[model samples]
Target: MTDPVLRLEALRHGYPTPQGRLPVLDGVDLSLSGGETMALTGESGAGKSTLLHLAAGLDTAESGVIEVCGADMAGRDDAGRAALRRAHIGVVFQQFNLVPSLRVGDNIAFQARLAGREDPGWTAELADRLGLSPLLSRWPEELSGGQQQRAAVGRALAARPALLLADEPTGNLDEASADAVMELMLELTRTAGCALLMATHSAALAARLGRRAQLRGGRLCDETGAAA
Candidate 1:
């Protein structure tokens, strides 16, 4: 089989606490091929977010390696890792992370501009597809929660990153809005040929993805098949 677009091998990470170095992930391994969508499901504080952070290069692994689009992140310095993330990773967080001052259109194009890859046509298309066309000129604070989330999704996908990491992208939306956003996210990620790794608490959401994995006791395992 071809190598995965994103891979984590023997990954371990933790944060310091008064007691000790509290391990968040322990020897976790995962792989995602191009156009594949994998749902990460687990209880609260099950290291789902930590795994996503490690995969996105937002945090470092204590031991092991994270490879994105064939580049080994383990050897890179912070700047190098940042460059990789900017160029090849798209992330959506539960908070939406939209800039209050920027208009919806500007927020959608921000990352692409940062990467020197702003595509006006792509941005327009994304805005239309995400149903943000009418709100393009409005500031983030003026939009509803679903609208803000949609803008965030558009922003992350506009850059056409090789890997897409989403942490509960639909967590705050109502059922109808959540389903709509999930459909749009899945469709757009497929169109972009990106690998998707989403951490969610919803079993129904996980069932929609190509595969499902559960995080528990600081490790990840396939929920439907044998352990990876």
Candidate 2:
């Protein structure tokens, strides 16, 4: 059997507030397998983004373990964690956070180059598949919203990471554009055999994935929890 690409064990995180430490994640546990996609849904202040941040190694958990691609996050220092993310994780943000200074093609190839795994052919193919071929030399600020989002997706995938973490990746797009980006993301993740965990507020978007999970009271629960 294939090992899970992501595993969270008894994770807990919180922030210090004037009142006290307001807990965000508590005893949360999850496992996601290769090439499988899971949707994370919840209302505002439910800690969806907090969970994604911890999984991506952008933040440290106050307690518990986070394992990605078999390596325990708890065992790694700051630089080690960064290296881990660079080598194995791809992230898409809600804001379409592309480098305005870099051209479309360069942005797509950036992470791959950092990982020392750049493949010019694959990068070009991704640009073509994403319909960004013509915009290769254009800067991100010159593109439309949909175009910018597509480029973000391409940039994330170019690294061919083992796991992909997306936070409301299509939230800024119109219905039609959102649907197209979601479909393309799934298609490419399947082709790369990458595991996906996307946090979205849209039920329709969550329904498209293989399984659904929810964050409530700082806990991670299955679809059944969505009812509670």
Candidate 3:
């Protein structure tokens, strides 16, 4: 494969507990090419979210290296990592972390503005594609769950970041709405040429992606149950 947009090597992370450090991820390694969509599936507490955090620079690993677009995160400070995330990464969570005070349009444009690349044309296109154009002025509280999720997705993709991380993005939606939102997300991500690492529990959803991996025993493995 070509050089990966995001790569992790021997990643290990854990939290403090009474019994010493409770390891979450253990020696995890992954590589994602640009415009590739990979689904991560596992049971609850399988370290899916933790791995996403490490990939997106939201959290640090205990050991090993994480590289985004060829920049190693191991030696970077908090501000540096944050800057990297702002420049080349976008994340969408299950909770649809939209700012209640900002309108839908503003929320979608927020990260782009922070990145100092707020292109009006791109933002408008995202709004229209995500079906948020009619409700651009509405607040998060005024929308349905599906609408809120769509807005969150639009916000993440509007900046055209090199990497997009999504955690249980369709967990709260009904089957029909989930299918529609997933289709839109796939289309938008492909159009933007963003590498997508999505953590989901649905096998059906995982099957739809270009590649599927599972998080088990504190590591990521391929679809045929072999280590990747």
Backbone clashes in each candidate structure, one number apiece?
Answer: 0, 0, 0
Best by TM-score: 1
Off by over 4 Å in 2: 226-228
Worst 10 residues of 1 by lDDT: 219-228
Expressed as tens digits, the lDDT of each residue in 1-228 for candidate 1 is 777889898999889999999988989988899999999988999898889888888887799989998898877889998999999999998888998889999999999999999999999998998788999999999999888998998999899888999999988788987888788778866787888899998989999999899888888877754565
Instruction: Return whichever of 1 and 2 wins on lDDT.
Output: 1
lDDT of each: 0.89, 0.88, 0.88
Q: Where does model 3 exceed 4 Å of error?
A: none
Output the number of the lDDT-best candidate. 1
Model 1 accuracy (lDDT, Cα) = 0.89
Per-model TM values vs. the true structure? 0.94, 0.94, 0.94
Q: Is candidate 1 or candidate 3 better by lDDT?
A: 1
Query: Residue 143 deviation, candidate 2, in Å?
Result: 1.9
- How should the candidates be ordered by lDDT, best one leading? 1, 2, 3
